[model samples]
Target chain A: MYSRDEFFLLIEDLSLLPAISPSCRSAFDKMEDPEASLIGIGHLIEEDPGLASRLIKVANSPFYPYSGKVGSVREALVRLGLETTRGVILTTSLFDRIRGEAGVYALWQHSLAVSMISRNIAGHLRMPYPDEVALAGLLHDIGKIPYFMHDASEMHRSISDVDPGRPDYKREKEAFGMDHMEIGEHLTISWRFPSIVCAPIRWHHNPAKSPEADRTVVRIVALGDLIASAYGLGHPEFPFVDGDILQLTEELNLLGAEVTSLLTDFLYDRDLIVQRSHDVF
Target chain B: MARMMKVELATTEDGEMIVQDVHDMLGRLLVRAPRRIDPELKRMLLARGIQEVFIPDQSSGDAEYERQIVEQERDAIRKRFSRLQDTPDNKRIVEIFIRAFEVFHAEKGKIPPV
Candidate 1:
């Protein structure tokens, strides 16, 4: 097994993936700056016509409450808010960069399911930043992308193996000396993602280990992941097992009645949400 | 004393008290139940593009909706999860998933499988 430092070296030496584009990274940094204006952020996003159009579509989606049609990037930026707009730009840019890689479509579909479910749970609980949670879910499993890009024989022997009784991460840890969560955490940190986005990526599988401030959102992602897997929208090899649902509810401190109510809402909207997930890409 | 019935929001009649909470497509609560169906509530639901809500009905019985929803999904879920160990947690999960599916469909209109 390779040491953690060696893993990083291998990733860099083999060119497993490229860093975030300089232009997108600069725009993201500007959005984070307190001195940045809405017009200024708009101008930066407008420089790339493709991103600008995608931002408008995301703004007009039913996720946001604005009734009027969004015509301009500036207006879309205002509608999405800075944090959520930043999340959108980051996720979409990453998704764009990884497009056409083998097995990316299935992976995207699973992420979309988790993203939609997580957002629904966030809204049902009246949590803040539901859209940001959606983006977090979308990017949670992104550490697996490098495996997909690795040599075909290695990818098949490691990631594609179906370990029926164990969690997916344990197998990944055995094979690569790091689980997907750890890999994901490292990648997001290198990309300079905020804690809100990175915490779920790292802690979703074991939410109790997350900091108190981020525990609830991490629990939401865990539940969303379980539910998605239960409904056959899960990752083929690493699906969360049966007891995970109960464990997560306990971690969230949800009483039996509350769990029942929350799950009823999830069941009610499952099909509609699943249908909407397909529209993401 | 009457059974609850799921009705399209646009067609709900006057004086029909909602028997359960009304939620939108995303599962956010709109109005808590045991409340009267007012024009204002209807307007709000319409504004939000909601299509249905559970209202008290004199014609059909309450048991049918729950039974139907559970029956439609129970076997399929059990088959899908057959590989899981037959523990209490797994059984409860299957039950909760199917039961919640029943409750939600009984409250709101059901979406048939595609």
Candidate 2:
């Protein structure tokens, strides 16, 4: 097993780790702005012309409800509001900016699927801040990005052998001394996201033992991950324990049927997002 | 001698102003108001089954402080980039932030604190 410090250090060493470009730093600081966060993010998207194009594409897609086709960032912001737009833009930017071409396509689809599922489940359960839950889902597997960046072919090998009923990801976590969720959490915190979000990304895998785990949000991502991982849709090759989910659902006051329905939508959206992954910078 | 802190409540609909100096009587934190006394709001709260509603802005009829963050941002950005002769993306990132700040300023009609 890799030592804990070593596993965490691998995350710290990511190439993009130190470059807190002024824009990103400012975004983190502006997170406290209660009134115009969406507008601010819309402004950010407009700056990255390519991201603006993709966001418009997704907003206009049939998956979301629109009075008509969304033709501009302002229209999209008006439709999604500040919280939801910020969530969507941040997720899209990370996928666009942080990964390499080789293995990123699949994970992008997976993260979106997880996000859709997590949001749907949160709404069904009457959980607070469904959009925030979706943001957590988008970020939950973020650790895998750096890991894939560090070594692509190795992750591909592991993907070929994943199974959840047995919990083999435990071994890999011990081997590397950390798992994807931990790595993702570190980056999210470094980016200055709220603790509500950073917690779920860290604990979605091992909710019971995770230091900052939020039962509802973590459960949403964990269950969504299971479906994605199982179907090989943005699928990672990692196994999760089944009973852990049952315990979490009970703790979070959610039902299996809600999760299953969300998973169906997630899988559907995953197809479209994956096909269009090339639209961003 | 304990200093009395006067607490008052006002809303668009109805209001209560308690003027007595509540020196030792005032609670350190907000306590739940008695349910039976607030029959109307209590009934609404029960139907929603959500106990708490978060109100973002808390204002008293106290002295209002004008917000002052946006005024210096453009200047800050210009000055920050002036020293970045060594790096380019650093310049780009700063530019992005300033643009974002502009959006915030435009929307809120004021700039945020630097």
In terms of DockQ, the best-performing candidate is 1
All DockQ scores: 0.12, 0.01
Which residue segments of model 1 deviate by more than 4 Å?
A1-3, A10-19, A63-67, A150-153, A156-159, A239-243, A255-257, A267-269, A273-278, B1-76, B79-85, B104-114
lDDT of 1: 0.68
iRMSD computed for candidate 2: 23.6
How much TM-score does chain B earn in each model? 0.48, 0.29
lDDT of each: 0.68, 0.53
Give the worst 10-residue stretch by lDDT in candidate 1 chain A.
A11-20
User: Which of the CAPRI classes, incorrect, acceptable, medium or high, describes model 2?
Assistant: incorrect
CA displacement after TM-score superposition, residue A181 of candidate 2 (Å): 1.7
In candidate 2 the C-alpha lDDT for residue A84 amounts to 55
Q: What is the DockQ of the complex in model 2? A: 0.01
Q: After superposition, how far is residue B71 of candidate 2 from its true place, in Å?
A: 66
Poorest stretch of ten by lDDT in candidate 1 chain B:
B59-68
